[model samples]
Target chain A: MSRIEGRFKQLAMQGRTVLIPYIVAGDPAQDVTVPLMHQLVESGADMIELGVAFSDPMAEGPVIQLAHERALASHTSLSSVLTMVQVFRETDATTPVLLMGYANPVMHMGYAAFADAAGAAGVDGLITVDIPPEEVDGINSELQRVGIDNIFLVAPTTPEERIAQIAARASGFIYYVSLKGVTGAGNLDTKEVASRLKLIRKHSDLPVAVGFGIKDAASAAAVATVADGVVVGSALVDTLAQAFAGGGDQAVALGSAGKLLKQIHQGIANAAS
Target chain B: MTRNTEENIFATVPDEQGRYGVYGGKYVSETLMAALAELESVYRMLSVDPDFQRQLDEDLTHYVGRPSPLYEASRWSDNIGGARIFLKREDLNHTGAHKINNTIGQALLAKHMGKKRVIAETGAGQHGVATATIAARLGLECLVFMGEEDIRRQALNVYRMKLLGAEVIPVTSGSRTLTDAMNEAMRDWVTNVDDTFYCIGTVAGPHPYPLLVRDFQCVIGREARAQSLNQVGRLPDALVACVGGGSNAIGLFHPFLEDSEVAMYGVEAGGHGISTDQHAAPLTAGSPGVLHGNRTYLMQDSDGQIMETHSVSAGLDYPGVGPEHSWLKDLGRVNYVVADDDEALRAFHTLTRVEGIMPALETSHALAYAETLAAQMTPQQMIIVNLSGRGDKDIHTVAEIDGIEF
Candidate 1:
């Protein structure tokens, strides 16, 4: 099993819910990002999902889009993001890092080079927003060869046959989109997510992480009850945005990250109890 | 260059990297690298699936009003005093433009991917209207990103999209037009990459979209090929069409690319003149640069920043041509030229008066170039132009220019 799967399994054995914190890498600035990522893990994050910034991020809402703009202004390329991952791994290597983003940049870099670089940077898995199961054959083989997990997404709209296809191709874990709209646009429907997870469970033995509108501790608690982990992004990005807007203080930004992750982790612990 | 193949025109010229010539390659930020790779895999699987092809054909035929009429413009031909001219009337398709052909195919792909939300960017609003229409039909929540300037200019299309149950979001960034709207739409796709599908309006963007849109719009060329052969007893001597991102031009030219005997011309919008900065003729004046998602001929300065383009026609105001068209120009398969604002205006009025067909300002550029080209050709020569869209949406702009509003 991969490191992420091993970590999740260990958490499951301890009756603890996995808290996955997501952030757009280079958002605000690269200097601040590595420290912030470390802060999230130090506080309570079990896994880290580092978002790769794309110029045209079709599925993002305004907040994350602004975050991407900030990162782009800093000229954050995929290589730069991998460097950040490498820097993080220097201090802490056990926590699994999943690079999440769209598919265009990877295609531009060529798949083999990307897989090698990502694996070298200590990236455990990948979650591309647009790639479906039908197209995973070549890339999946390449990633598997590099010992990197090629994660798949299963939405509420996914048909049973497609779910089975995705389950078969997916590795590390499956990401369950909580709603139909862009991130931060709509409220998450816990009952609907629970039912979707139940359906996904029948197809894949992989752990499923629910995301897209898991805003606060309550929503995280709700998702933890049904999902293997809860992925929080926009809310954490919003916290960082607020902190940055006030002033460029590392302590303030790190404090906010710690507070947000602690709240969600506490909620997850309480729910499990 | 294989002469005969069971596969369609798209299967003929695959790029060295497995792309569709130079048209379909992923050019995006590093963040989107993984996602695009995954999407490319899914697209390949679905492209050859018999079930997918069958379903797509059914939707195109029954839903999108396929096999659009091939009407010979008798009056216009007589006025030109030369060879007969035929129009493959894609404007008569559902949503009043050729945009639906692409939207329907993309919406289906979105459904197959289990995406429940559809998003699109529009300049003239025809694409937005079409995307919204299909999204509603497919029971998917639709969101359209339009530049603030476009929303003000294409008010009717905005209302139409909203009436069709889509939320129109006005983008106020960059140049505050189609490109900005496109940027916003891409941003949205990146954030919600898992559950949302972006229905690009034209034959542009990164790999898959340019190829995919061209494939969907290929119905125009496929039908016209048979119709012209049946009506005129042979193929036309020349095929002419406008090139706003070159979707319509590609749709018409693709089927005829291998026909060495048939000449093809793509009319670019020379807003004022090619020498001036106020034009959308990317192939004529711009160099190859990567923007949005793919590297293609783009109107940019020496500094590489995308330059602002001006055109009377909102639809043709974009600063880039589709990547496939760029490749075709280099390969010498099709001739790319430009038509100025005055020439297009004259052609627009002439077609409305002589043929009683109010052509869109974008299409008028093609007609304008055809008129000039026809003057130089013999009476025996013939031309086939793709009437990509109707002029109804452009009536207001025409009236404003002529100082006579309805």
Candidate 2:
């Protein structure tokens, strides 16, 4: 089993809900990303999903869009993102880090080079939002050769038969989108998401991480009740935006990350109890 | 065997990697990560939904005028060395262009999603006009973003969009053209994510869009298939269309992709020449990069910044093409070549004088190529060209070029 899968299994046995914190890599500045990632883990994050920036992100919400713009303005390439992952690995090697982004950067770099670089950078897995099962073969073989998990998504709209296909290929975990539309645009229908999760569980033995529109502690708590983990992105990016807009000193940003992580943890813990 | 031939071409596409060839892939912002995922799911569901297909078919037949005809241009054919040429008359659609085929399909999708507003970006104003027409018909508030330069050049189209009750927003950003207008439209979609739908003009953008738009525009090919077979007693020797964002080209070529006996050509704009930076031939000079919503072939500078493109025909002035076309070219299924401004202008006048048809400057590129190809072939050879739009909008521009007071 992969490190992320093992961690999830351990957490499951301990009756603990996994908290996955997501942040846009190279946002604000490339130099500060590793520190912020460390801060996230130190606060309470069990796994880290680092978003690689792209120029035209059609499916993004405003919060993440601004973050991408900031990264692109700094000219953050996929190479730089992997370099950051390598830097993070220098200090903390065991903490699972997944590169979460679109497929262009991977395609642009060539699949073999990307898989090698990602493996060397200590990236445990990849969750490309746009690489469907039909297109996975282009990069899947390289990823498998490098021992990197090819994570897949199963949405509420995914039929049962399709879910089985996705689950068969999916490693690491299945990212279950909790709602329709872009992230940060809609409210989560907990009952609907939970029922969908139940259906996914029947077909796939993989851990399910629910994301999209998991804004506050309450939403996180609601998701934790049914999902193996809760992936929070826009809200965290929103917090970073507010902190930076309000004079982002290092102390202020770290403090913001700590406070948000603690609240989300409390919510998940409360829901589990 | 009949059904198998039809299925073979489409099966080659959306390959094991969801790519049409090497052309289609997700090249997007990290912010939209989850949203793209959700869209993929919804698209997969809707693609096979009987209700969705029925609704789209109904709109295409009753609303957009299904099965636009294949007119055998006998006069033009006789003038061009007696080589027979037929025109798929998408220009006769309700909006005077083929762009409505896609806008109407996307508008219905927006309605199904409960979106109250629709936003679009335009270059030659055909897409903007199509979007505005659909938005008005669907009873949704519409906004169209166009480059300030395009707004000035295509003034009548801008007026038409306004008359259709769409708010035309002038974009004064980089190059002040289609690419910049698309950027502005994306910004609008990002801000108004709650109840807005972004109606992309062509078979471009993220994953599902390339697939979705192609499916909608396939009616052009499907209709032409029956018409051509009935009229010519067999399939044409060649399929030709001009590629801007590649909607019309795909519309015509898609149904014939698997016909090994038939050849396909997509003419790109070689503004000054292919060697110069002034051309809009992405397949000829561009590298694979992410622009708009998906990763496709794009004309970009060394720094990976998209370059400004130029074409005498505003519709053919884009720096990138639909992802599927990129893939198609890579797979060698279609030959993508360029026709310079001089050649296009020559054909534009030739069509007007010989055939009494004032072809759109965009379609003139294909005609120019056809003229050249016709000279090299015998009279027995046949070519079917997609006459995508009328030249009415270009009269002012053409007249000005001729030093005539319009």
Highest TM-score among the candidates is held by which one?
Answer: 2
Highest-DockQ candidate: 2
Model 1 TM-score is 0.72
Name the regions of candidate 1 deviating beyond 4 angstroms: B1-121, B127-145, B155-169, B172-233, B245-247, B250-260, B266-313, B317-359, B364-379, B390-406
Per-model i-RMS: 7.7, 5.7
Residue range B1-406, candidate 2, lDDT tens digits: 1344455766666653346665666544333434456656776788799999898888888987877889888888887784688888888888888899999888878888788999999998999999999999989999999999888778889999999999999987667788878877876765566677888888887666778788888888888888878887888888889998899999888988777778899999999999999999998888987677666898876435567899988888898899889878877889998899989989899888887777888999998998887767778988888989888878777877889995
DockQ (CA atoms), all models: 0.09, 0.10
Q: Whole-model lDDT for model 2 versus the true structure?
A: 0.83
- What DockQ class does candidate 2 belong to? incorrect
In candidate 2, list every pair of residues with a backbone clash: A57-B29, A59-B32, A60-B31, A60-B32, A135-B17, A135-B18
Indicate the worst ten consecutive residues by lDDT in candidate 2 chain B. B27-36
| lDDT: worst 10-residue window of model 2 chain A | A53-62
